[model samples]
Target: MMMMNKPNWRLLATAAVVSAALTACGGDDGNDGNSGEDGRPGGEPATSVSTLNLKVTDASFSNGLPVFTLLATNEDDEAVVGLQGLKVNVAQLLPAGHQVVGDPTKWQFAGDDSRNGAAEIVDQKNGYYTVTFTSLDKAQLDPNFTRRLNIVSPAGTLIDGTTEVPNGQASFDYNAAGAAADYTRNIVATDSCAACHGEGNGIHHGSYVEPETCATCHDGLKAEGGRTNRSFAVLVHDVHKVAAAEDADGHIQYPTELSSCNVCHETSAPAEELAITEWGNWSAVPSKENCASCHADNNHIMEQADSSRCASCHTAEGTGVVKGTIDAHLGEWNDAAEVISQWGSDVEMAYFADTDTTTVTVSITDANGQKLAADQVLPQIKRIEVLTNLGPNYPVLSYGAGSHLDAVSNGELANNTTIVDGSFVLPITGLPYGAEGTDADTAFSFVGLAACSKGNAIVACADVADPDNTDNYTGMKANMAFVTKSGFTPSKRHTDSLEFSKCEGCHNDNWQIHKGYHSGFVMTEQVAHDEEGKVIGLDGCVTCHTPDGTYAFNNNGAWEQKLHVVHGDKNIINDCTQCHTSFNLNAFAKKGPINTGAGANPYADGLYGTPITATCASCHSYPSAIDHMTGGTFGNGVYDVDKADAQLAVSAENCFVCHAPDVADHSNVKF
Candidate 1:
């Protein structure tokens, strides 16, 4: 159950008409109105209930009837009443099968998500409720058998009763004796999905957050659309495997390689308790239903193995060299995984004076950290380019050919030849930024290339493949380096912060998303094994996607907006914690709006969105969602912008009023 340590907000919201104190929430770049004396927005206290936590404490099944008892409480541990519109379902926790990817013991579903009509609900109106499911087949069920009760309630009907909307689930298991038994179906945790989809922000329009809750009803296949039945394996595999898997418009592009199975079936996190159980079931316990979900497009192979084929060729006994599901997908082929790690970048841009030029040194080194000789790996360098941007912060106002140096300006520079001394010094001659701002950094991103080395010999990744490793021929991942305006001290910029390892957790260190241009990464550090043991600090991508114009990298404008828009379309982005280091709303509120590529920056000339709304719109870009955003009913704010109104707008939405800053708040659902 959740507790509302927060102050009451309705009183404060009622105090003002200008306040957008509705239930809807927007994203980052919040231009906060007033840090009120009471430490809340607009000097308000949040006493009104925002979200309710339901606990299914006890469950019992006797003969043909099953009963589930629950207690509902608001965030402050206060008893919550009046929560109606319950969609309850009971299912037996079945054993895993081999023919299909479903549990056979599950029986409560009568199609659709809810089992309706035959429930006797007894609400004491004091947080307790006894729900008995009638009309259950006596011979099919057992009171002593392990069973699960899934209580799903709609977001409203007041929970003293409710003030905000949070579609959630309260599921518990029990035997006839009211004791815990063998109900161990915890294969993947909610955080696994939350790591990408944001917790409680996806599936059934965000109604069900827990995977176990989903499995209770979804274990068996049911016909949906025109094609096959909708099972957990079928729906999930289709949504993630291909571009048009779920979308009719075919706009969704799977972010990582389709073969990257371990992205979801991850075995370990940074800690042991965080580790998942039975993760290897994806391969070990194969099923025909699981294989056909994604390989429906591969007609020939599917037809050949049509008879309950659990990809038996790749199973324990018969497959060729590759063994299981994990062995089927290709691994990273980044040609320079080693050399790039050893190299270092030294950038010098003297910017106290406007006319001063900058110099950059690339100290290419061998695996031993010594300088590389001309005869060494240097010949393997097929391609290399340096990218620069005015940083220390993001929404880069200037860079490239056509710069949008708006309200924020540091200095000016152009592409010019430079002279600096090192084993290999490449320089850009430009006037330094005038701002002597301490730690004001200039971002420099590098993209280098080398053939996959065969032992110590430099060989083209394609040619040297005793096995075909041509995917490595393109570009090499490189580290991002930043330097202070003093051009002497190194620094780091404040961009969209995320754990580099977290990204690697899915994409792996060899990910070069840009392909020909290189995806730009190789894990130099591991959060699971570090000295200080930090899990954050991986800021990149904004350097090329700045407003200064890198059309190749930017379309929806700023990195903040683009990241959400791009990923949101593919899978899920509403869960901010998936990529964000933390929800530092105070810092986010002070940030600026995103430029939707106006003035020859080529994104849809002169279109802009307010920071929070723009980022929210990145994913919630439907007409209905926008109406909720522009305050059609909630509150008012001019979020959408045109070239005429080029100025960035301040935060005006009331998203935070509903989405309190904490781990438990439904709006900011961070796992």
Candidate 2:
């Protein structure tokens, strides 16, 4: 790939932080100015002899009795002479999902004058108290249970002054979920989500959902991408991670914006429709009462979300929860050793089915008779195949060529060997070919791979024979193409299909037309467009089609379609038999190509090369007009943001594909 400009990591980091500030604390709607402790604007009950301030130094949920260190000071700033008679109490705000199903646990004090649920202060030094709470039984704690802490005095007096010293708040948000709090939301089951997040939809965080079903977004569904960007475990941690930067009150002073929770979630009094909104979806901004509903514990503030919450709900036996088995599997991959090896290639053999082509094929397998698949491998494996130099100058030759090679489907090449099989293929003239086998520059190449499945296409059974012994067997790995070294440069003047422009450079220009821009370019050339002057591309419709790929801009905002079906629909117009035409991007994104007839294209285009305006009119009327302007709300429901957002999850761009450059409205461009 041609080098353009290096990414400014600092700017990106700043932007991420800025985006996060938009949703920290919901507005305190319930905690209006008049509702203070004791139900007054301020101060304790009238005629109080002396005021007592109880603060917790160390309070954690280790064994129900949250260990706490306390400190008390009189109004005069003097150590009360009697110092031995102050009373104390500890309270906890039971989080949602963890309801009190039995006799609630009662508090009992440890000092001589202390009564059950009451305690006497002994010294002026930091006072320490451990309040033992009834541990949540398996029945009470939902695998996604979240709760908060509430500190109180022995006589049931609220510890209003007890805020964390560093941040000055005693309460903090705590989640039973893993490291992250539920951050992102999924919309698979709800028409609201399917309306926007399903297929042909793009609104929330890049629209990353999986399974394309209710489980994709609903906590009650399959529960995979239920919270925090879809992964419940990861979501819990990220939610509290905001504490690492934002303050306890949820203010982002440096970024010039108030902490606004509505930035991502949309909460309001939920409606009765199937498109109902939850406590999390109140408005573009949620009020503080909505937040305090869950984040009652001030301690969870400014600290990372506790992953221990995950263990609370997703234990040994729970559906839609991360089981212990999943954790163990992830750990195994985390601990695996990185392996390194060198191999050779054959140049004279056939790389692609067609001769004189710069391609190669290889397959990997495990000792098992069963084929290895994507789901079986740990996600961390970065296979490295080193290529040794049989010649000298070839090193420079290979390096110069590798930079120009872009495998449209796979990410960066991670291996160093060329022609992955033990053989190699030298180059021919008239093509971007070079002698790779001379020096490090020529002989080496690198190709990167993510964990896919465990079974090989040919492997029938595990070599271990016994299921328990499967871990002891070694698995096989192979590369699919000829890799050239990074050092290779163009031998003569060369130009890119986009004339030296990066994919992002041209793609971003027409971000709306392509639907999913600046992301992956799947082979969705045959995808369909709506019959209403909308821009439909493969990125939005490939959810069900690719199965493996995620999305941001979906096509119909209703049902997620597959590639073959989408492409076939575009070509058929009126005939049904046209579905068999040779469009392949959707399938290719999921499964690698076979040879030529019924498989993937080893080499795929980075852009949508062929124009299919004919298909554009199927859903959109021809001679697109400025419906929102000249006709006063004349365009499809897409051109208007509020209207589009109010409609079933379709984006304004979906209507812009054929409207602009063909119609007279620039207002959509303003959006």
Candidate 3:
């Protein structure tokens, strides 16, 4: 996972020579140079840089000033000649108690036009350069200070004639006592930020590549605009606040709550304790404004109030109770139900294919393992439903006719009884038979809403309007049973890659994005049996997204690409590994180079019509893809001039004909 610094020059050069020798010879048809129908000459060798390596050869202190020498070379083991306008930045890492006071300066070299300032760069011929720090202030130096170096080339460098090499960085630690200083503790991983910021670059105008480097400049000081920028802790928190800023449509641009703390602050420590410590240090003292960020409804605290009021509910000793801020923010449903007598239900379903009918039987019981009487159950239960999964094509079928069904009015029951001795049997009509072959079996699940009734009415139920309440009486009974077909066995579809807990990590208890059912009750039959039969839970979604399922809309329903397109619409698709694991991305590549029409078209929207190799380079390095494409035949031979549009279209078999092995390494197809 480290950056690309070392490249094998010998191998690259040898491969280039071999490829040129092979191309110099004629083809099987004895055609040396011929123009195709598209007005492009065939067998034109691809010109690319074999290697571009930037390295720090040596570093030392000269008369209390730090000096370093850098070297740049190409694949032929020769100096990179005539490189100009190279910019280099040097920053000293400060200790925990210290802070930066002013903007640091960068050293630039333009050959003979270079100017000597606080830092000077001198060309030493043959790709070597000596840089020296001129003005050294002992007050800015410490026994434990470390230096970080970053070098970047101007707009274009002659690597493969026109390709530009990416920047590189190196770190140097200096100790006055001639010993190594203990490395500072990192609060957050760069990969987490790269998940949305595209490899840690292209964020904040590419000025900073890593968080440590960012801390050097944005260290709680006023910038050129006369506005003070807070420390990293405060800046990051305030920037991502749910109501911090709004877009033209009056919607919050970065709508994330503090409840999703684990998504970023995912240390080994308990998230609850980590959040308290992080926020406590950031604010120093709690304020009503801080509390109002997430708890806008709780208006008990005054603006001038200190941490004492917050500690009353957020600390164990202050309130004479064990509850704290964690318990208060997580909501009541996080813990077990308090009532001693709890209610539950068990359901069984039998289907009759000839009559297109399904018979459902339900039994009710209490926490003490005793069946309640029919009259007692009828008054406590709110509703009961039977949901059926009818294979891949058809949607799930729900048997609940209306909002609330009365025992006496709804007469689809056996013997016209809704509940008899805590049990009831109802026959529902118009259920379709299961599909043939692998999908011949059907799954039926039951849902019952049991409430703590007040005055013969179910009150304090769990609804979308008020989701934090624990008084909601909801229970699910999922049972897999074959329809009235002989020798039929039901099985689940492919294993899901995305976990429900992962979604809950950001969406919290309420699946707020969809703005309907909460994640807490997504698996229940009530939410799973929607009007469109859109399976509510992540587990149920795979049934409808199976190989045989209908997916004419949205990238032909290729789950991975469709997910990318959806997130791209929301401007969240930056790094591929954000949603997919490294193993998953490798597996996708193993399915062979994409865009050959083997699977559903994965390119859409932001990536629509993008080249196959260029798209592959989004997650992979350009050099690695060059090796894969040149190792063997790739892509279809037919290159559609209109289909390619702006992307490179070439058969893997003839990739080397256009892109020579050496120049391929420095191609501009990658991000």
Q: RMSD to native for every prediction?
A: 12.6, 22.8, 16.4
Of 2 and 3, the candidate ranking higher by lDDT? 3
lDDT of 1 by residue, 1-671 (tens): 11001111331222121122111111111223235322112323234445666655455555446665665656554556666776776665445542344322332343222233366887766555678766642124455466666777767655345465456466555555544444444455565665556656646645777676677667543332111246676677776776434234322245555665545654332323333444445665555556677787666546654334444456633366655454453223322344344443222323333634444444445555566643343335433345555553543434353221111001111133222332334454442343454333453443333344453245543344331233434334443445555655544444334555456644555444554333233434521222233321234455556533355424574666666666765655555566666555654454455664434444445456555666666666777766776673452333546633423235455555555544233265223
lDDT at residue 420 of model 2 (Cα atoms): 32
Candidate 3: lDDT over CA atoms?
Answer: 0.38
lDDT of 2 by residue, 1-671 (tens): 11112232322332233223212222111212223432112323222214443333233344333333333333332221222323332222223222222211111111111332322233423223334443322123233333333333322222333321111112222333211224222211222222212221222332222212212221221222112122331232233334224344432212111122211222222233212222222222222222233354645422424332433443333345444422222223322111101111111213232443433222223333233333232222222222221111112222112232322112113223233332222332223333453223222222222221123221212322432222322112222222333334311100111111121221211111111111111111111122231222222222122211122112221111222233333231222211212222122111111111111221221111001111222233223532422132332332222221323322222333334331222222423
Instruction: For model 1, state the Cα shift of residue 527 in Å.
Output: 10
The local distance difference test score of each candidate is 0.47, 0.25, 0.38
Residue pairs in clash, model 3: 46-658, 46-659, 46-660, 48-663, 49-663, 633-653, 634-652, 634-653
How many pairs in model 3 have backbone atoms within 3 A of each other, for residues 3 or more apart or on separate chains, i.e. clashes?
8
- For TM-score, candidate 2 versus 3, the one ahead is 3
| Residue-pair clash count for candidate 2 | 127
Name the 10 consecutive residues with the lowest summed lDDT in model 3.
103-112
Q: Estimate each model's TM-score.
A: 0.65, 0.23, 0.46
lDDT: the better of candidates 1 and 3: 1
Instruction: Report the Cα lDDT for residue 613, model 2.
Output: 16
Q: To one decimal, what is the Cα RMSD in angstroms of model 1 from the true structure?
A: 12.6
Looking at candidate 1, what is the lDDT of residue 550?
57
